[model samples]
Target: MNYQYNNFYEILEKNAKNLKNKPAYFLNNRKISWERVKKKVDTFARALEIIGVKKGDLVPVLVGNSIEFIVAILAIQKLSAVAVPVNTFLKEEEITFILNDTEAEILIASSKFKNNLKNIRNNTNIKKIIWEGEVENIDENNISFSEILSNFESHEVKELPKRNDLAVIIYTSGTTGKPKGAMLTYKNFFSNIYGINELIKLTNKDRFIAYLPMFHSFTLTVNILLPMFYGSPVVIIRSIMPFSKIIKETLLKRVTIFTGVPDVYSALSRAKLPFYFHWFNKIRFFVSGAAPLAGEVLERFSKKFKRAKLLEGYGLSECSPVVAVNRAELQKPSSVGPAIPGVEVKIVNDELIEVPKGVAGEIIVKGDNVMKGYYKREDATQQTIINGWLLTGDIGKIDEDGYIYILDRKKDLIISKGVNIYPREIEEICLKFPGIKECAVIGKKENNDEIPVAFIELEDNAEFNEIEFKKYLKKHLANYKIPKAFYVIDELPKNATGKVLKRKLRENIEEYMK
Candidate 1:
């Protein structure tokens, strides 16, 4: 498909005109057509204008995965304003840091997070607060979303943003430190949407499940933008509570494409589907991203579903969130498949020289999907994107067939006794233990030497014998690669995207060891 349009407004207008009454979103058992979405977005854009939002302004959106969240972002884009999506899971301090850092003038938050916003309202640059749902205490600056839509007239922006203009500033998950905003332009999103469409082959008849948070780049592109671009309807679940209900809804809605993290797939793998309901047969395929999908989890899910294949994908927030994905025709469970169209990926050494096919090195990407830069952080932008290629901190290798295999994050590598050790390898082996539910391997500094430490989370009513597990590891790993200590914990710290927080594990190693 040739992408004739540049900005998001053009796409929405075209889809609304072409697909008209076709459902664009499925929220709370209600189907919102493309025409309705366009109308709502237009009214919201006018409301934003009345509230003093203008071109180039940053509007921080702190909402969940609901229809309002989708409409708010589209409205911001229509007005040519930058949407800074804040993770709803963030604390007041973290949200405040992003708001003050971006100097966001407008904040659009859901009712559930009103208190969080109220806690830091006085410390932010926000002049207007648009509340999506009802709140107990409302202030002068707090405007109701329903009131805005009812009061404002449906209108278009006088001038739409150019393709190169900034559209969204997606803040990183900040597992290590303060999150940095990645500036994505209108062109970046369009190019990525086109590239992904070429690979996924989504159609208007397809229905996706939008359970992941929209703040993450992965969900924004795949779940939200992709469906809107194709004029496909998305089943937007406000919450993932009562997992069985979500499954029943998927089956009832006949959701075609499901995108989720490893944890979700793991849970689904263990779920006992009703004998009468063969709901999974309606799903065309399942996609795993955000975190590494275990082979064991994939095998179990594939066996259980029996209809859809769970394809593992790899990407980062900087690359419009999708760099490589497994094509159904040429699927490889171990590899993340080849780079998607319009993206160039190559493995390079420490000196940035291209490495051999089988050798592991830093993965660098050169593509239109790459972010403009880290907002207001020139040093970080320079360090990340050199020349035209973005230096992805992930360590990976490409096979002779062009498939990419991720080893581990470069920063997560353990250097013990001058020998480099990948924690992923250790963790992968540890997960094979029958009782182990989840595990993370990290390096502990001990007398100027890095000691490999393993943190294990056991399944319910499961027990772990350290000596037996260590003996099992000896068969598959070398003596030096084995973890020096094993600590069982109730749960491992994770970010919103479900990626294990290794940095947190390292910080709290003392408590875990005790």
Candidate 2:
């Protein structure tokens, strides 16, 4: 914990020398500035150090959401290497099993994922492929990330990297299965943008849309390194399901920060267009974390956008993700604000101890954005970073003004007759029902015990009525939080950065209990 920020390419070369000519990013009608994003991140960090790609070498990229994924992740951290991004929607045997499990050798990509990695280029060992635009046959040892940034020359400035090495690996969606590699560092991504810029302030005339998924650590630290650590601008947007062009690129690019999830605010509260389908209040704060939004999607965007606020935060992916955030003088509609400055939140018990205020346990944390573990799996990083806290398999509590709340996932609770439950409190009473749009719940079993089970999704031209959706979830649930069964689905199985794949909805309830 000695970080006085040791080089993330010297904080993007000091925000490209103090926001030189400002505008930092606005892809797809191109804006770019911070001095042409620091001369294309120093000519792609001298074309990734003339292909030897040094310091911790991982590279990978596989782009989509361009500015060549921000000049290949600040030119793989200006040659300290380690980026690893991928997930240009995976699959080519999960992108050659993460370029043969992160032994990656510089594969940068985006000419449509280099034409889908040219059909698994003879099963990738990777050794240099670059490719961002004109994709032709690529066989002759592939190269063309704008011709390796026009054959690099940029020179000098090198030696910086070690804030505990490894910069980014990410991967998640393992859901108790395969995908591992979390790693992170550069002091877990610059102490999570200096601990969420000590609670969100952001600058360079703000902006922010970034339709989540720069291989998501909530858009790699809230819309990419917290809006490139305040030289802000962002925009990006490469599909988070076309909500009418993400509401025409957040109200014709006036976008002053949007950051969604919880199905992009229940698909813009069931969009029909002409903007405000209840609260897009022309940006400036909409937030909502990677999942859980329903309090009827924040009461229909506060009864149709009464000048937007929606906020609700919480974290995971081992906390470079942001721990608690609800902001605006700590507003707590379902909590999650409070613990940001140098982060500490407690809860414990199972002998780790803490517990008191509003009881529920296991949330832990201790900050400078917690992570640096899980990559080479040290027994799954000693069952998740013990001595300095980080447990967070989440089950929360805190309130008494320190906010927090959360309560479900400690492996998504629900014990049934032995009591517990919390399927996000019956998927927030089956998302207050009129056409339900998205839900999950999951507990199921029965004769052998357990119970709950929901899996919904509805709303595209509605009509599932199911006894008025269980009498509008019995007027906001509590018959053990309702849902003994629902199962609708036109979609609901996310996770590539869209959350809700509750283990594929509990393997579709073990194939409907076989």
Candidate 3:
């Protein structure tokens, strides 16, 4: 369990030397070897240096999950620069805010997002715009991906970054306000890589499917960092659309480890597979994170796949994102499992006192994997991390056996007549309905009182009876905890990371009032 590598670069170098001809990345029917990836990283690092990107400089990357995006980030790490990955689904205003807030010297983006960047060029401090694909009307400042690789010569970089040096700045999904960048150092990522490595026990022979958004911490660590650290091959698929393609790739490549959000698993569970769909049998297991995975979804997925085990985990952007996960051997479907190695987690009451076992309280963590602080937001950072513990803002309970059960987000709690109601509890019950595809529970204000409301999306050709649903809920929950009203919707508003934006649902409460 001793990790000999000091930094991410060292991990890559070690993997390249040991697994030279192995396929490091599989994308678009092309296999990129570890040796070639190392060479491309070196060449891109030289190109970045030629363009005046020095150590500690921030380089904001706006790209999808592709080989070029991987190369760009590895190149930035080679030069000890911080890679600020912007969510691809952000509005122009939000993207502009991140670029300005980070003061990024260079913006490396795919050509698909050029329109979003074109409008904000004059407003930010970006000196160079490097496009990963083809583009028209290119100028000196706006350069293409091929041009950089062809123009710059590959050279060895001697200046290595320290473990404490800042590596990347991940912006929170910002369900409430403007997104704040979580500053993660090399040590943070390295510690998490090791911690997760011990849990999953991945090897060079393992193949992973890289379908989640790379900007998010869960995808970055599990799909990218873990595979590279263990010299495993990753199959990169840019789009999750036409999910048949995902199934095809997973089967064809024999993907062993699949990491995804709860929504992805829910969809896969509902997808109708052919009788010959024996491809998933090769998959070792599936990991669910980003949002809470409903027990119903896990049960359905396990029944459908038959051979695949769906494990739930918990994390946030601030903790280099892998706080705890369930192990395959000692699986607990209800718990996200104990804290990973090298990390300490505890449940604290309102006054920050450690709560007794089996009592719900705020979950806080202290470890090397915790982020340094929020970028340029000292007040918010202070509020999030107090007394050297990163306050997770999540409500959960730890059992005497050390299994952690997440109850709900502290902010998502609803108070009705001095009684506390957790929205997750209602949503979990709503999911048990036969026709319910997706659902969200929020508190709506009515005449100075808060009332629980349920918004649901039904499956195709599925029937909905409000009375029957209420009758079903009465058996599982107290009358005060049941939703006062239920509104049928097509879909819930989600952020780039696939988390439901409850704030948006709260804003449109009038639409659901009827």
Candidate 4:
């Protein structure tokens, strides 16, 4: 990829000069200009430096979505320190684990998460804590965010960070086990920014939305960084609860591009929206990522909003969270489209041999967008990246036309008596049933025999009859492929990015069966 800027600071400085008065972002009624952001970033970096932050220092940030969150990360990069953004949804134990593991000395957190840090000072190595909101119970370790911003004058860094320098360490959502931190350089991020922009046409004129959790890689790359790379303004929503606030912002701010998960689209597909909202909105693209989009959700959403294209995308944290997405020029149903420009994606078998087109196998990617490796896990780094190809633990197949179709996660694959069963195939068929709104299939061990069992989430006030559902499935699938049992639920457990928590299902299967 032909990246224009060497690092994030380069882009920020350029935007400060080229688009000085332009609004960098919009939060509710407040508009922050690029010039103002640049001043705050430099001042914050100066204060951090005075506090002993140096090159290669890891600073943990537990802040939520706010102007402080953005400026703090820029300041960390400005001082050539690695920014470790922890998920705000994680518990105190999980949060402490990351801070202790990184050996961080400073933590930038929001006031809302103070309850989680009530006992944190005794547990971790964090010496200084910077809070974004009101400071009531101030101590020696606590510092106000506003005070830090005004304490120091705008200062330049002694040394600028290189493109290869580690910029961020993103902790994966620990569904299977302990969260692993993925080390990403500035180049790994810039590669995806340029690659995705090449496929989806975007300019400085377009306005985007940042409602998803910024700690997630999908939100950080596609929502936050991409807009900054283009000098486009973003509408920042604090939380997804009462998402009608997001709708109000979209219409009022004239947002042109939106990114969401499958659940958001499914809810929108069935919303009783007025015709005027559709006629007046300027939305050009509706992109889905983080998890696979159900065929039912995709179809209903496209039919509801014909003017906007609903493009399904696929990616993971290891690949800078953007491997491929469908473009406006061409789109195939249920496909994530082709790999982005300058990135090569292929399928391989168990022996690491290339698989033929239309054959399902492990998906591996090779590009500048691939991350450096898991932080402090050399064995894992070697196991994941072989021969320069990042072995994505995902199973998929590529068509002759280069469109990619993700089958399922390799770890989620179910084996029953020498037979392989992909849960997505069964879940897709289950979603087509009238009352079902969401579905998940997982392997259940019963008396040494493994069988596929399904969990179904139904629509509002909908009733389900197992006999009819079984008869319907028998027509579409063979006997061995059918789920042995079905459990109805009000809603499936989901992460911040709307990915179904299949691991949670596996853990609770016994209790539900009782």
**Candidate that scores best on TM-score:** 4
Where model 1 places Cα greater than 4 Å from the true spot, the runs are: 136-140
Residue pairs in collision within model 4: none
lDDT for each candidate structure: 0.87, 0.75, 0.87, 0.91
Cα lDDT tens digits for candidate 2, 183-266 = 777776676677666666777677888877777778777786777767778888787665577667777778877877877776
Comparison by TM-score, 1 against 4, better one: 4
lDDT value, residue 72 of candidate 4? 95
**C-alpha lDDT (0 to 100) for residue 135 of candidate 1:** 60
lDDT for 364 (candidate 4)? 96
Q: Estimate each model's TM-score.
A: 0.97, 0.33, 0.97, 0.98
- Which of candidates 2 and 3 is the stronger one according to lDDT? 3
Evaluated against the true structure, the overall lDDT of model 2 is 0.75
Counting only residues 3 or more apart in sequence or on different chains, how many pairs clash (N, Cα, C under 3 Å) in candidate 4?
0
Instruction: Tell how far residue 386 is off in model 2, in angstroms.
Output: 55
Put down candidate 1 lDDT per residue, 1-514, tens digits, no spaces: 3557768888889889999998888887799988988888999999898888888899999999888898899899888889988899988888999999999878998888876776665898788789988865566687899888787899766788888899999998887788899999877887778888787788988999988888889999989888878888899888777677678778888889989999999888877778756643488889999998877787788788776777888888888888898888887766888998999999999999999999989999988889999999999999999988999899999998899988889999889999989888888888878989999999999999998989999999999899999889999999999999999899999999789999999888888767
